[model samples]
Target: MTLSEELLMAYDRQLRTDAETPSAIGIERLGPLRLVTFAGGRGFVTYQDLAGASARTISHWVAEALAFYRSDPAIARVEWKTRGHDHAPGLHGALLDNGFEPDETESIMIGPAHSLNVQVQLPPGVSLRRVSAERDIRAMSAMQDEVFGVDASDGNADAILRRVAREDGMELWVAEHEGAIVSAGRLEPVPDTDFAGIWGGATRAEWRGQGIYRALTAARARAALALGKTLIHSDSTEYSRPILERYGLRRVSTTTPYRWRR
Candidate 1:
């Protein structure tokens, strides 16, 4: 396999499978569809490739998964993750008809963690560290929500607290300036994989170009290295893509999510 392909497999094997929220969501086989349900009242459907499935079968899979989610009142939303490389026919139309809205088309990036794990110079008065205390986590999550344009979510903070209670390898990192969070991210070490996922990266709008996020990432990379993880992966948005790209991660593929929300 080519280097990029190798990195992609590393990502699937190491990072994606260990998604605490998504991975734990047990998979349900509905014909050709693998319906995934997570703890957060979220459902997801994804397949390696849909080459063998006929259009009718593909539609059937979509309908079945939707029915599965619709039947669950607790399921607030569902995301059908599609890879650009998948050969599933008529996926777009089927999902739209099923009341799924498309999120941004994200680049499926993969590469060496060490490449981006370098020492980034943080702006003056900015500092990075990992936090576990409830107070600090609350502060961090609130800042991230605001930076990323998301509403306040106790789910994320609760997840971290849950992880801390279980002593899970998940760690929350933040960049703080003058007692306020300016940037934040999470490092998740997937079991049975040689990689860790760097997720939930956000920087306050005014804090951009200040090198805080990079420093936060660098801190996470350092933590990953200490954990014996050699690779890192993230589903990046346009805002953080260039920063990660500068660190040597490549855009290997694209991920399109079809969302079904209540």
Candidate 2:
């Protein structure tokens, strides 16, 4: 197998299950699926694979999983995370049949952590730091929400603060310019695994192409390396994919989130 395939295999083996939901408030099992509940009334569905179930069986699992989430009044929305490398049949149609809408597909990126640890020169007056204070975290979250075109609410910041309180080895990094956050990301080190994930990367539109995001990614990668993580992974949008690829991260696969709202 190629190096990218080998890395992808390692990701599937180690990053599924509990590693995928470290901040989960509760989890229940349905066949091979892990039904996860987060702090913000969000339900998530993931699994190693569908266990080679036939199309009919997969459809049944989808209905059952949807019912399981629907029963909980606290769950306002649920996301079924689908990976492109899986062999399950008829999953796209099954999701749509069950009132699930597919979101944008993202590239599954993986590579050596050290490759991203290299220094990238930032624009003048731009600097990177690891944020922990509630105020800083809140600002970073809001900046990300703006960049991603989501509502700037406290749900994500609250969840992140709770995770910080648990001391889960998740680091938040940001690039600040003129006292404002221009780029940000998260580094999560998976316990007992050689991998850490760099997630939630964003850059303000005006700041794009100035190397702020690249520096932020490198900062997160350095933090990962400091924690003994040799491999890094991310599900990257098109905006960030080329930057990661330039740093030696390979596009191993694709992932699309199917959303269901109550």
C-alpha root-mean-square deviation, each candidate: 2.1, 0.8
lDDT of 2 by residue, 1-262 (tens): 9998898889899998699889999999999999999988999999998899999999999999999999999999999999999998999999999999999999999999999988888899999999999999999999999989999999988989999999999999989988999999999999999999999998999999988888889888888999999999999999899999999999999999999999
Clash list (residue pairs), candidate 2: none
Q: What is the C-alpha local distance difference test score of candidate 2?
A: 0.93
lDDT of 1 by residue, 125-171 (tens): 88888898899998988888787677989986775676667766889
The superposed Cα distance between candidate 1 and the true structure at residue 50, in angstroms, equals: 3.2
TM-score of each: 0.91, 0.98
Total clashes in model 2, counting residue pairs 3 or more apart in sequence or in different chains:
0
- List the candidate 1 regions with Cα displacement exceeding 4 Å: 12-25
Candidate 2 Cα deviation (angstroms), residue 190: 0.6
**Local distance difference test scores for all models:** 0.79, 0.93
Clash pairs, model 1 backbone: none
